[model samples]
Target: MAGKSIIDVLENIPREVIYTIVLIAMILPLLRPLGLPVPVSEPIKKWYDAIESLPPGSLVLISHCNLGAYPAFDSMQVATLHHLFSRPVKLVFFSIDATGLVVYDTLLSKVDPKAYGKVYGVDYFHIGYIPGGETAMKALAEDFKAAVPSDYKGTPIDQIPMAKDIKDIRDFTMIICFTSAGETSIGWIRQWIVVRPEIKYLCCVLDMMLPTMRPYYEAGQVAALTGSAPGGEYEFLIGKPGSGIKKADAFTGAQLILLVFIIIGNIASIAKRMGKGGVR
Candidate 1:
């Protein structure tokens, strides 16, 4: 230890210490987030504004299609639902895939619309999973009742006051889909958006799908777009810090720590080389 060079010391940082620091950085934020500021990007800002600008009593349709990978889009869905519930809009949730029903229920439980003074049958409705993929989406666009005759709980749609007027896709004031696959968005675009061009469309998709949808967004087919890391940004913009905020805080802390270590290591290497007359 006495003869060890500064470079050696810096490069030999104990794996245990690094792991411990990283663990603390992640866990602390989950327990008590630092409330760090997250910058709002154009896409997320657009998504927020689209919801904020909706008129009261406007009915919204949300399509959930990523059931197996809930963790990836859970924060986005929660934050979106929280924002929607905060407004005067009526929401109708449906799934494109069978597994999406489980994910939808999980998110509903976590967001707890009841806490926001929203009633199940009066303020919001959940129609559960509808199979047939593109064909089902087309049917829903033309005749929602025929596509989904009952709610997720087997209750007739006619019994739900909020769903009484939702006859087809055009009945919705806005359409928002959180999907992990391109087919989900493409189906909506072909069956719903193309048929009813007036209905506003917004999507929250995986980061990789951004390129596939960017052209539509640019052409005004999608009023707003957000995905992946932008979920945290949306949470920040909404001023309702949730899991996304905590995750962002931890991510920022970890990156900062990594940057600091990189700087120190470089400095130590340079100093050691200078002491050795630049031989190394």
Candidate 2:
């Protein structure tokens, strides 16, 4: 190590070596999570709290709005489904966009409500994709029966035991909307919240939508606000670790490794400026 200055060693780290180190940092956690301390953020806390407080027979409405963001929203939706199914609450599923139906199979396959002993018509139901976007939102608020013609399986809504009693937006004790089309989210507020205002609404959007939607939470229009980023926190709080937890571990490991490289790069740059090498 004498002939090669510290700067030289740091700067000459093989590209493959750097990549391998990063890969290891990411892979180890997925294989065996270190169970690193996960600080629960306020947003995740609020969302978890809302779910925890649901009455035994409370009915909850779930709407997934992102058409092409399964990679982005999968953890949030999966962790949420796990938490909900863990409780004795009922759930109704639908999509704001027609394209979002692709998400149902992926999400349900991961959650597998049967594993939780959830019977389809009794505990939960998926009403499939409703195509009207904001227009759909308004109709849903005024009349749930009119808006949803049949279950996602094509069974008439009236025939579905769990859905038979659902009258309008007012029937659901809480409304949880995953990050979706902005207007569609606002449509829920205008059509549902503005008129009723008692329904507990939590808007789960992407990290970027926090700024725009945070005010709704602050204004007490939305019961709680969360996003895709801190989805792992929900898992931690509920004591059910899944994709969110694994993603959190991998993410933390990768970031720390990148930070070390950043620090080493800065040190090498400073050493050069101080004339440690012959070139300087």
Candidate 3:
């Protein structure tokens, strides 16, 4: 029997070794983030631009419904909130999903508005969790104060000072929502968007739901619609490193390692085929 050639030896490399290499690639970044470059996509650019275009004293209504995940809700939520608070925009936050209340607290704890020199009731305030899913959106759209007469903590809407003039749905320069629920996300378009054609809506939803909501973005009904896939790109654009960068590094590292292995395997296969033929 003929001894193995170089191609044969290469093709016979152990699968366990490849798996171990990929595992190591993913883990090393989590321990110490490599600060790898994450390219910004067009949608992410649109999202950032929408926020950046906000003029001073621009009112932005914020909504989020995210049950926390390590890098899912963590990256975009923290980074975007930091960007929003850094500016001079006035924000009003509310939650449609009941579970999102917890996310609100956790999110705020990480990026405190006060730290950005924002006063709670005036610059930003949470309206807490409004129970009715789509119905709440409709009511809030038609009558901002009638829907919720008080702030999240039961403070009267009139007392907040900033929220006092939200008499019209068109009052806000934009409405930003980070959501996982199809109802709340799509509901924003149906309820508020349809009624007020001019209001810009920025949506950051779960990546899995991107395809379902992408039509709106393409049609231009949604100012910007996206998910957390390129969250590291967003962080870099905003100049804050968080879970996005770490997550991107881990996944990219594993992928690059696997890609190298796949390329090697294909080359070995071609070499073996040529060696058996009269070609080489």
lDDT of each: 0.84, 0.84, 0.84
Residue 132 CA displacement from its true place in model 2, Å: 1.7
Poorest stretch of ten by lDDT in candidate 1 = 271-280
Candidate 1 — which residues are off by over 4 angstroms? 1-36, 253-280
Clashes within 3 Å, all models in order: 0, 0, 0
- Residues 160-192 of candidate 2: C-alpha lDDT, one tens digit per residue: 898888898778888888865677667788877
Off by over 4 Å in 3: 1-25, 68-71, 254-280
Q: Which digits, one per residue and each the tens of the lDDT, describe model 3 over residues 1-280?
A: 1676667766778899988999999999989888776888888899899889899999888897657543476888788899999998998999886777788888888897878999988899888788888899888888889988888789988899888888868787898988877887889899988888788999988888999898988887799887866788898889898778778989888989989988988888987777752332
Candidate 2 lDDT score relative to the true structure: 0.84
Index of the highest-TM-score prediction = 3
Between 1 and 2, whose TM-score is larger? 2
The candidate with the higher TM-score, 2 or 3, is: 3
Pairs clashing within candidate 2: none
Ranking by TM-score: 3, 2, 1
